[model samples]
Target: IGLSFVPDLKLANSLYALGSCYNTIALIYTKLSDHLRALEFHHNALAISKRIDNRRSVAQSYNNIANIYQDLEDYDSAMVYYERSLALKTEGNDRAGMASTLNNMGELMLATNRLNEAEKFFLESLEIKSESGNRAGEVYTQNNLARLALLKKDFPGAEQYLDITERTAQELGLLDELRVNYELRIALLKELNRPADAFRYSELLMVVKDSLMNREKAEALAGIQIAYEVSERDRQIAFLEKEGELRKSQLALRNTLIVVSLIILGLVYLQFRREHRNKEQIKTLLREMYHRFKNNLQLLSSVLSLSARELTDEQALQAVRSSESRVNAMALIHRKLFERKDEARSINLRDYITELITYLIHAYGYHERGIQTDLSLEPVQVDIDKAIPLGLIINELISNAFKHAFIDHQSPCLTVGSKLEEKATLNIEIRDNGVGMRPPAERRGESFGLKLVNMLMNELRGKYEVSTQSGTRYVLIIPL
Candidate 1:
């Protein structure tokens, strides 16, 4: 129809219709797991939508294209398009569109495993929907937020959010909300370990689904009657000709779809290769950085050692040892990076920590007479960025306790351990079998190193408590 129409008479409308058709077709391809074909149709829709100068439609094209990328798990590409869509929505001041874009952004964040940012965007959209009395959209966003809470194991919060969606949907008779509400309620119940409640909601979900099918069948019957009446004359006279045209169109469409699929796959391959190269470059940069870093830390460690040699005073030796311990902690990270497999962002925490402890014990002479460092380790892999700060903090605390806490002692022993606590929290315990801390550690001339350790602990969003009877014990709780 668009091709048959006069360009001057319906140029904008034809372009808009072409874009809509391509977008719809793209979604079907995406659902059928043909991502490449879906991408081609998405581009086609984008072209026509831009031709028509419809900003909202162009934004929609960006969103649909992003959806295909999301399905392929190409988060970087998906994010690019989502930002494009958001920019268009903002430029147009489309409140409803903005709300939708926020929801999409939240979903993309969720996919990338950034739960905090996802919650913020989802709630932001919900707030707009609720204030504008867009109850339907509000229920949709609430449903998404509820699922998010469930994913985070926040069952109570999920239930609370679902309750709001349920009340709004039930009060206003919004069937779409009811469908999602029933299914999500079942999921929340299951996550809460209430199987019976989950089963009951599941039954309700089926009932809702059946009712929707019946309603759709009834509506389709009416639509079919109208369509038959409108096309009766043409249907009778040109039936075989229309059939031949339809068959030829189907064949051509099939061929076009195949070509589009190959194009999309080619594009995906190119994208993957580019990202692989980028990751490799980043790894090389990191390794070079660590090499330089190790050199600097060694220089610092040498300075501290020479200072201790130059000064025979006990107090000055303790200060130099403390600084050396800090340098060693920094040096350990560089050593581990070189030893690790070629990758960015992921590190085996257990291996890294064990190597670090062994290095520290050897460096500080844990096996030496009258000195023993006991470390209890378990399997734990934390992102290196987080683990680096935490390892340094541990080093600082242990060095301080080993120095002043065991002053003039017959023998000295230090222990450090980390355990996985409830709700993904990491609990670290560092203790020393030595003279306890000087009473009112904050008031006395405590080492500046201790002050810095406390600051790093705060930066980790960790909670720390100390106790001393025979020896000093420090407990730290940090959530991952």
Candidate 2:
């Protein structure tokens, strides 16, 4: 009829009618899963629509083509055609068409694991569908949103979305949407631990599947026979035609394989070189940063020493020296980090304590003071942030033990040990065999260093207890 009326109707109207007929036939072919035939008819419709300058028809053709590619799982090509359809639909201000295209794009995004982008598109499509009174499209969009919510583990949100989808699908008699609604409800019920409810939905899903299969089988049996016969004839013709061109195709395939192999080799070599360069760049940058940090701390320590020498007051001089020691303790951490081959942001606590104790013994002149040290540190790793404060606290406690704890004892002994406790906590004990802690009132005047230790412990988010039963024993517990 369209062909018969081509001479009577206006040129544009005749072309549009022809395009519409081809598009309808293409849709039928798509539903029958004859994708090659669908593609052919869609391309024909697209050409006629373009010739007639019918923007809406052109967009429809693009959408049909995109759906075929999506069914074929050629997602890249599907995306290209979908975007083209979207641009044309937007230009024509076709809200319904825009909503449909947006839903397709959302499904593509969801399949690609672009969850956030999929949710955005689904929401926008839902708004458009609702405004246009497209209840069926709205239900589809709601199903997409429900699936997205499930992916995010937002069970309550998914339930709400699915409820709306189910209500809409039932009211409108939309069997396709209802099928998806049943499936999602089943999954949601399972997640909520309602096995009985989930089983009911599962039974409904089976019923829907059986009904759909029966209907499809009835409609498709004759069509499939006809299609198979036609395809067989075409295949025979194609086989005969290909027989003449067999040599050419084989030569082309060989050349293509050689080119692809070379391209793959080139890509592998480039990737290897790029990864190697990136690794080298990161190592150089880390080493330079650590070097600069250590130098800055050393410079600060030198400045503190000079200032301490200038000060005449004994109290002020002692304060400057204490500050310098704390700075040096932090510098030692960066020094070890720079020297180690492992690029981890944590340090070995045992090694750090060993080095720190050696430094303290030499600084306090305890070598000639008959001071015996027993260090038992477990092999534990501490991050840089916690390590700094922990190092400072240990420095203060050990320094006080040497200076104040052993003043009256002829044989001085200091013991430090660390062990891993339950719940990934670290327990450290520092004990000195000397005079125990003083009374609170008497220690207040000389408690400046002890106050610093308290502040450092707070920074570490740790708790400490001091016992003076036989000698001073400070136990510190820190969570990893």
Scored by CA lDDT, what does every candidate get?
0.71, 0.77
The local distance difference test score of model 1 is 0.71
lDDT of 2 by residue, 246-363 (tens): 4534433333333334435545754465345434433444455566677878999999989987999988877887888888888888898888785455789999999988888877
The total of clashing pairs for model 1 equals 0
* Model 1 vs. true fold: TM: 0.46
Q: Backbone clashes in each candidate structure, one number apiece?
A: 0, 0
Lowest lDDT sum, 10 consecutive residues, model 1, at: 1-10
Q: What is the TM-score of each candidate against the true structure?
A: 0.46, 0.46
Compose the digit string of candidate 1's lDDT tens values, residues 48-74: 788878889999888888878888899
RMSD to truth, every model: 18.5, 21.0
